[model samples]
Target: MYFPFRQLLASSLALTALTIPARAQISIGEPIPFTDTFSGTLLDDTFLVLTAWRTDTGSVNGGLFGRTFVGLTNEPVGEATVSAQSSTTAPNFFMARNSASLSVENAEAARYTTQSSHGTHTQVEFFTPTSLTPARTRFHWNVSGLTSSTYPGVVTNADLRFAAGYFPTTSYYDFFDLATQENGGPLMSVSGTGAFSYNLPLLLNQPIDLFYHTVAYVGFTAEGGETFSGFSDFSNTHILDRIELFDSNDVLISEWGMREISSGQVMFDQNGRTAAANGGNNIPEPGTLGLLALGGAALLGRVCRRTKKGN
Candidate 1:
């Protein structure tokens, strides 16, 4: 009996080891399509946002601060919109559009600031369950149609830009660091294809602790101005069709996307990962726990036989 039980226990342990799935690149699929990926319309849900309209903050120019949507849609407020904007501020949203176009044409008239000569166009922060590594994770985004005249009387130095702390940085809050902005980071742009792309390859693979990290967030401010006068009216249009995350194998791990679905409400996505991305059991996994119990039973049976023989 002893010999058989020992053999059985060893076999069970071997089986458990075999069953554990090897670690691979985490690939979480797109769970939901925002009623309008944050167009912030009547149908939109699960967003944490604060907006102002026709109001001027007199904030520091080229800095992201004052009345920005700092906590805009995150996982905590899933399926319900959490927002505060001026009552008079009409919602600048439309039904979900295919392939994002981030040019002046699609530029939201309601910007971070309403001050004419100085303003911030747009700002968004994305904090996800998974933090991307410079080596293992690569980002792919597309841009189509760059037009400067979309905004009336504004076409000088008109450019479409994103926050520099976007991909490499983990904290959504770092975007507001005045010093970081002072670096005059290069603007968001693509090669001159009818539609261009933003694809950067890292020099070394820098990995951050998973889940505890921040996704990137940046503000887009197109300051269209003249040499003598400061930025007057700002205007630029761009269509951002896709934002994809890939692995070394060139497989898509996640996607921040633009799409339309049929019936069901979209699931919550923190950045590219799902709301449940950052979670784990402190104890052994379920299968391992069960195997441990079976081993204990086998050991008890062996002890019972020895006691009976002594009696």
Candidate 2:
């Protein structure tokens, strides 16, 4: 379930000083699998933040960047309305799930400024509480979605974008604008079912955060006052049927199922027992990375704006 940023921040800060014990080095051919099928009524509590925003603007610095917080109360099924600068142009963006999958979409089209632009951005993140330093790692997942834009008039730019990947560290400045190096080399291109396995160049002992992000953007100059509409439609849906992780020899190192994630039992190892269960060790709590990243982005934006003004 989703927790408020304030509550999550407080808890994360309190646990910041705690240390996470490194897992025993997983050897090849040892089964230590981790898998997750979205069969639960709620997203795993390890998902610390869910956020979305829409913007309409006449100038780069003059857009109304409306932001919204998605709560766990509506999980397994819910939608939030993204308001545009104009009163008549509200669009509904939803993040819903059933016993089988999680879906994200913006059903209604957003209206763009007659001679400017409009866009929507959504992101969700999952925190890894433990440190995994396996010599070799394999990652796999599934997805199906589409984005479209309709401009009854003239247009200069239009596009829909989606990206999924993980951060090696718990801290980040921007979720949507992460540099390639920040996401562990290259970001995963999420479309159909895909998987990749690679050997580590060095031992990694810190926890990582997995993230999924999407953007629907359009820029146009209306002709004869004709309006423009655009959206990211995934009605067919994106399903995380299963996410499995394995070591070099294809042995399971750790696994997560919908039930375990939904219930916040995210700190488990190969034997299906949490660190606490193995002994008294506790996984390091994650900070409010989502909010912190957004704040950093805003600050960076302001800095860039001031520099532009100076020029």
Candidate 3:
């Protein structure tokens, strides 16, 4: 039977959709493992931190760290009180007030080899998803100053670890691992029906602010690399952001950087997405960041100049 051209097209289009892969609807739910932020308060063994997880095993640093307390550990025994340091109960807005770190001198023999080297995550905790069915969980984090991080030496196998506990014991989800020693780190991600994981790397030796606006849930993910960065340093600021793991301690390193134990959120898609977002997140341009890095040019002098339409 003959039918109208427009109707025939509509019928054909509807049939085509039947063959396409189906998409599932999802959304973010309340945090599962943590409700409030604190210096230490984690379920032992569930929250894991390594002084040098995979950066590079050495004679100086190595071993897994479990954070089941409320403050820094491995601190040297009693000694004369020097000056002092300052940390805040509330983190400065849009900045990483929470901090963590490890030292080679205080670390035990490498967890991997005889000469181990690495640092532990400050707030190590175990996490599992119970909100949505299953999909790649999105990660959103922020940093304030160079003091967010510190590294006086080098590391070899630093990586962003993405894992999963999975519902009904789903498949292994460790595909979101990558070597994070390159420029601006890695700005990428992955997703699928079963699970998802993504990471944003930090730029070395620079002060920068960052944010994540998208919702791509990573079922169960954790961020910590190298266990330790060898000669590394981390603190809330000059006074608080420190890891004194030595008997003869001296605050020789500090930078405006990021937290060793980053604050992350797991989000899901409300409208649902068939694929993942693959875009270059951020890599400061030489003209813009270069000037800021040196403090040679006024903040707006060069960037504000623009030609008005038609002279």
Candidate 4:
């Protein structure tokens, strides 16, 4: 019995040496998708979708501080497009001195239009395409166009944008504050900043055949930007760079965007190399795959040795 136990332990150690780990990339049939083949899917290589929507101290005339969405697609994401904009302002307490909200103007894939020119403003909607494959998706909010003279609350630029993840069943907060000219309601006062997020979840195919919703809270604040309300010399615009999506592993799965700040409305750019473009399928590096295979073989060898000893 002692001899058999000793032989089993030896086999176990040998098996451990032969075992190899699996890569993070999804199999062809898996439901999730990748936006970019981030760092070739190494265990430590994670991906993130980045977009900027406003600049605090930069010129606003060139870019509109635009807003747009990235439709979710389970299939290998093909042709993709990115769009952003900046808008003119109107004078009003609802538009300025709000400090909590930014000026609102422009609309796309939405029915609401801009009724105010200079006060607080915003665009709200889910980025998830009405028809697309469902997975746990995350939307990245990128913001710019702020400074200590313009935004004082933040110590770093990365803290400017707001990232909110929402499920499917989440309810929308009405903008009644701006509507009724009251600060206590939904729409708050206007600041020099813009806010955005995509918290809605798309449909997923699974055992329950039920929906998996990921609702999120989206928007941004002026922090402590210079007050332009009740004054004409004060003016500003929020410019967004792009909206990005990621998978459960925190890997940047795919994105639909562009780098040109002054470019026209968002359109498909073939130059992007996000994972969605690669169909979330990538070849595992030989070094790592080889290690995993070796580990598996070692495990099998150990089991075989133990069986032989028992016999």
lDDT tens digits, residues 1-311, model 1? Answer: 01000001112212222132322111221111111011111111111222221111111111121112222221222222222211111111110111111122223222221111111122122222445532233333322222222333322222222332223332211222223223544234222223433443323322211110001111123232211111211112222333444556665546332111211112123153222212211111222233333332221121101011110
1-311: candidate 3 lDDT, tens digit per residue: 11000000111111111111112101121111111111211111121221211101110012112111122243431221111121212222211222332232222322211011111111211222222222122233222222221232222111112222221211111111222224333323211111223332222232222211111100101122322322111222111111111111322112111221123321112322112211111111111122122121111111111122220
Q: What lDDT does model 4 reach?
A: 0.20
121: Cα error in model 1, Å: 9.8
Q: Write the per-residue lDDT of candidate 2 for residues 59-153, one digit (tens) a residue.
A: 11121122222222222212322222111111212111111111223322221211111122222222333354343333323333343445433
What lDDT is obtained when candidate 2 is compared to the true structure? Answer: 0.25
Tell me the tens digit of each residue's lDDT in model 4 across 106-214. Answer: 2112111000111111112223332332344333332234332122221111111122222222111111112311432222222233464434343232111111111
Top TM-score prediction, candidate number = 2
- RMSD to native for every prediction? 26.2, 15.5, 26.7, 28.7
In model 2, the worst 10-residue window by lDDT is 302-311
Native-to-model Cα distance after best TM-score fit, residue 153 in candidate 2, in Å: 8.2
Q: Which stretches of candidate 1 lie over 4 Å from their true place?
A: 1-157, 164-194, 200-237, 254-311
TM-score of 1: 0.24
Candidate achieving higher TM-score, 1 or 3 = 1
TM-score for each predicted model, relative to the true structure? 0.24, 0.35, 0.21, 0.22
Pairing residues by index, what is the TM-score of model 4?
0.22
Model 2 residue 82 CA deviation (Å) reads 14
Sorting all predicted structures by lDDT, with the top scorer first, yields 2, 1, 4, 3
